[model samples]
Target: MKTRQALFLVWAACTALANHGAWAQNNPVLLADVKAPRVLMVEEATGTVLLSRKPDEPFAPGSIAKMMTVETVLDALSRSEISLDTTYPVTEFAWRTGGAPSRTTTMFAALRSNITVRDLLSGVIVQNANDGCIVLAEGLAGSEPAFVTRMNERANTLGLSGSRFGNSTGLPPAESSMTAIDMVRLARHMRTAYPQVLPLYTQADFEWNRIRQRNKNPLLGTIAGVDGFAAGFAEGAGFSLMATAMRGDTRLYLAMSGLASEKERQDEAARLLEWGFNGFTSLTVYGAGNVVGQAVVYGGAAEKVALAPREDVRVYAPTGDLGRLSAQVVYRGPIRAPINRDQEVGRIRIMIGDAVLQEAPVYTSEAVGEGGLASRAKDAVWSLLFSWL
Candidate 1:
């Protein structure tokens, strides 16, 4: 499907297509031929590791290092420390240093030329301009080394334990390295907290001084629902991609680092995306105010109270997995009377593995009205109300 978002990803529906053998068996195993040891596919919302292969192991980040670059730039822009309209004077060094050495990312670059910060950002992101990356980095932090420090600092703040930054645009003589899990973590962070920055990854094309540059991501227009994210390749790093797709509330994010070939990476990523959706589901069995279960009452007018699957419990487990899912309700100590029907009497814990996926609130089923004088008197005398109700 063609999207107004610059046709960054597309799916080949060509006739006589291959029947993607994507379903990782129940005892899923990575292809024996797979060279990359790390791969991770996670559901962004819940952090469910759907499929993984040594995902925590660190590897070359390749141009994907630019992921951090884009993030730092977005942070500065969002904080108003800088503006897209702010212009930077392209010095001789900025021209000769960025991009693939001798090649500039944007057209506004010529000795002594001036380009706005917005233009430079577009170069770094939309055009994958090395020059733009250095300029934006220097513009914000006064030098690439300072900017690199800021990037690492941000990475630490985000809990990217396996990630580090050496340069703004990932290039040869790499000193930076990150794990696939860490890359997925970065993608998840961007997708959840900084979505406005997400569009930069899908920029199909960019223009500078009458020059046009197309995004290097081949999946943008070819894959359905593929929006923002990035792709990277280098002899040392092979090809890597961190991408997401939105199929309604069910959005899937996948990351593969250290692939042996471009085709393998895309094929594997697309396969994982398709499998995640086809084999899993999002079931919101409960909504706020929806009575889910009944809980026993104590010293109350009603014999029992209602419990709910509080906070809308949604799961991404395999189909039919919801049927086996279970919950445990909890609330503070001995129950009291006069409870509001909407009161959060307890919480529901949903579990699949050992982990408690989520906790939803459960409320009293009915208003536990105060007992009558006789009932109170009975409670005071025989203490049966607390036992009977």
Candidate 2:
């Protein structure tokens, strides 16, 4: 028995192998474990789940709630409701809750002083300014509760059904909750919709009221591709991070919560990102409009029709042992006659072990007409003869 098979898979004259036992072998990258309560890494390009641990489990967001706050402010800006220079007066409640005398982390805004939207954003995103978020919420929606209603609406619109927001800042009212998966979806949506705001996450520090505060995103500067995102921690939540990094056209978003310490969160995020980038390589299994296989025709003039991929089939798989990937043409058999060109008849499912990487629809390259009576009889005989082959 050939227990270990090395099958040569060809696409566009490129030889890729699928190793049957590659995953069973000892691999250190797969063994590097992350110590976090929940973690998830998704490649934005292909929407592949590179790593997931309790991605849907709800957990406290801590200060990472500011991500949504910034998003809401950006939404208002898009709607022409506010601008970068628009200034809002700080209220007594905002100052008392998240501002200067409360002992919580603040952007150090002066009481009753007016600040621009840009400055407050820097306070919220760069400084994790709790008071800054409250100020922005009030400025945008007239009250924190109203702003939070909009926040929940935004979450629902973005398909983040698992997330719930009670406050603009991810502070612990204990009711504010989000899952790792939901956070990643939120990050993906924010980056896709409002790319201009991402650079704010990279800003190292913000200075206000003669006090300079640095961005708390632990992955920034420490990791190569990591650019902007937020990190949060609370008494019960421990440490949580929502980070996104880009290497070429491929962007990876990571969301992790419930780490014992900041160092552990950073370390875990770094390891996971490294593993995602270094451990995997994108392989194109089928090119667009290229014939992958042929399907038998029952009543067509031609005995068989060519099947091609309707779109390009690309997948991210482990770097080495390319042979571990396998592809198959799957569809209901004995395709009927009078098929038109580019008609979807089947699909090419590319898989790595049991996991489906991509499924590209197979289309007919040329039309096939119905067979004449005599031809149909001959074809029936031929099909009967070759059906067992």
Candidate 3:
């Protein structure tokens, strides 16, 4: 089985290479003329923006709007609010909705047609099916409009902060808008939280009879280790994408919008990914429950108590920048009686220069017991008799 799996991987890689060559040749040659709209490459493990060009500015996003749909769907699946194998009856309205030129795409929404939720998701992600998206949205949320509302709500929950959604398929002329930074956040969520659903982005081809269709995402074939993402183009949105690639422990994600052609998008993505992977390193700051120092405890048998961290925290930074950082444990103590293990008794503020990186919790390692009546009386007498001393 291992041998067969290895052979399959080799075959897939070779196929991607050959197809990438063809794709490279077929790429539009005009992108060099445009000023190059904007590009942002981000690292997932670290909230590092390796490259930023108007990363915070909003762009039309074209079919990249479908990212909201993907996110919403995956979130629902993760929440156990829906099942993958459940089937939906495709409505005629879904069939009529227009989208990418891929026949393998079907949202399983046609009158008298039934499709499993898994098929609809695969179609939307792999094929960028317009109709499939509409059907899935309608079936899941009772209507497309309602589904979009959920998408926006999820965006806020994600702290996306700057993105807005108006359609599920993202085949706008819709009000959909997303910034490169926001899109990177979406990509991070997809990459980290829904690892199983990622394959839909790497799918090169899909078949629904004679209408075999292919994914238009250029990064899959051109960039080594690039996989899982969507690409879209419209007259207003131009060409845009959310792309990811992995090399060793370092992974790169880039969001490009308003590009001239598919080829340029791929090249730009590669450039950013290359720079990011070659330019950075991530380090572990400290382990969970690490005993940085003994905390002062009063009214207990011991004058100081164990001071352990509540959680593990790490930092991802450019090499040589690690030592400039320092940590301080802060608390309001003389901690009265009664303490618990692993409690959020204090916080350790990690700082690099003036920027606060992460402030993790510090626990009360041991409970502080109350002073007994006799002990309290003795302490009072000693304090009164020798107050001046």
Candidate 4:
């Protein structure tokens, strides 16, 4: 088994290199020409940005802020703070602030109507219903302002430095802003950490109060493999989209803000996703549990310990390869003994040219016990001999 695994690893490495050579002959267009003022496309497995434009510049996110609403509610559900079946009273604040008379987009929840968390999620995510968000906010956190505070806390926890939430619906008060990159990160985290809610994003239409309205996501059903997320538009924010799609094993995320119109938003998002799928192919350099390399150990029974990735090590190769990709095994060296098997000790940094795309944590493959006197002396001798050489 060990021999076959070793042979497979060697063969995989060689095959990847040969494919790199073949790909170099074809020059693929860079995404600099993509016209969206702010856009980002990230390959999920490797955290590789196939394309990005002003990703960090904050702008009005419109309803894309609802993704955070979906995420936060799902988290509350998981913690048993709420349940799919739990119902909340539709407060006047929810109705008057975001409901029909306000002339804002809504799920049409009647004043003081009791609604389930599940139904509200569908309304907010699928319909981008502002009333649904306010209701959930008021129900879960007592008020929209308190819920907005939680959203910011969650955003900060997610490392979304360029994002702030002014309301559950991402309405503008000048304080709510998010960069394309931050939106992408938020979407990716939600998809990965809370996959159950993703299907709600794809629902074609939601019905409430006997009024059925179709989902506003332009890419839904139109774009192959496209799953739904959220879209937003405010008078000042223009149109924004945070959408994701999966084909085969690869999932790609896109976030764009300030699109001139709905048509432009759809066109730019589709073009970007198409470019991503066509512009990059991924390479699995190390499978989970496969020993990537070895690390020197001190005071251990073994002089060196096998290092394996905590998860699979995948790297994105541009559709038409520039050259063979490279990576480096990085860790604090000469790991001291009493190391347990499966202990995290280091990481594998996947690289494209001088840039690092992904870092997969590496771990010890077996326990390293404290060495006996004889073994210690032998290691000491080996170190001395290697130093002399």
**Tens digits of per-residue lDDT for model 4, 285-319:** 67788876788776688888888887777777675
**Candidate 1 deviant stretches above 4 angstroms:** 1-36, 44-47, 100-108, 192-198, 234-236, 289-309, 320-323, 328-389
Clashing pairs in 2: 17-322, 17-323, 18-323, 18-324, 19-323, 19-324
Question: TM-scores, in order shown?
Answer: 0.72, 0.84, 0.67, 0.79
lDDT of each: 0.68, 0.80, 0.67, 0.79
- 1-389: candidate 2 lDDT, tens digit per residue: 11121222223222344322354332435423667768888888777777778999998888888888888889889999889999998999999999978888899888899999999998888888989999999998999999999999988887888889889987766368889998998888888899788788898888999998777777778898898788888787789999999887778888888889877887888888877887777666677877777887766899888888867788776766466677777766567678899988777777767777766777899999998888677766765765564
Measured with C-alpha atoms, the lDDT of residue 37 in candidate 1 is: 62
By lDDT, who's the top model here? 2
Report the poorest 10 consecutive residues by lDDT, candidate 4.
Answer: 1-10
The residue-by-residue lDDT of candidate 1 on 153-270, one tens digit each, is 9999888999888888776664888888788778877777776656777788887767787986767887778886778876666788878887777777777877778888877767
Q: List the residue pairs that clash in candidate 4.
A: 63-232
What is the C-alpha lDDT profile of model 3 across 173-194, one tens digit per residue?
Answer: 5788888888888888777798
Residue-pair clashes per candidate:
19, 6, 5, 1
Compared with the true structure, the alpha-carbon lDDT of candidate 1 equals 0.68
Find the number of clashing residue pairs for candidate 4: 1
**For model 3, what is the C-alpha lDDT against the true structure?**
0.67
Clashes of 3: 5
Candidates 3 and 4, the one with greater TM-score: 4
Model with the higher TM-score, candidate 2 or 4: 2
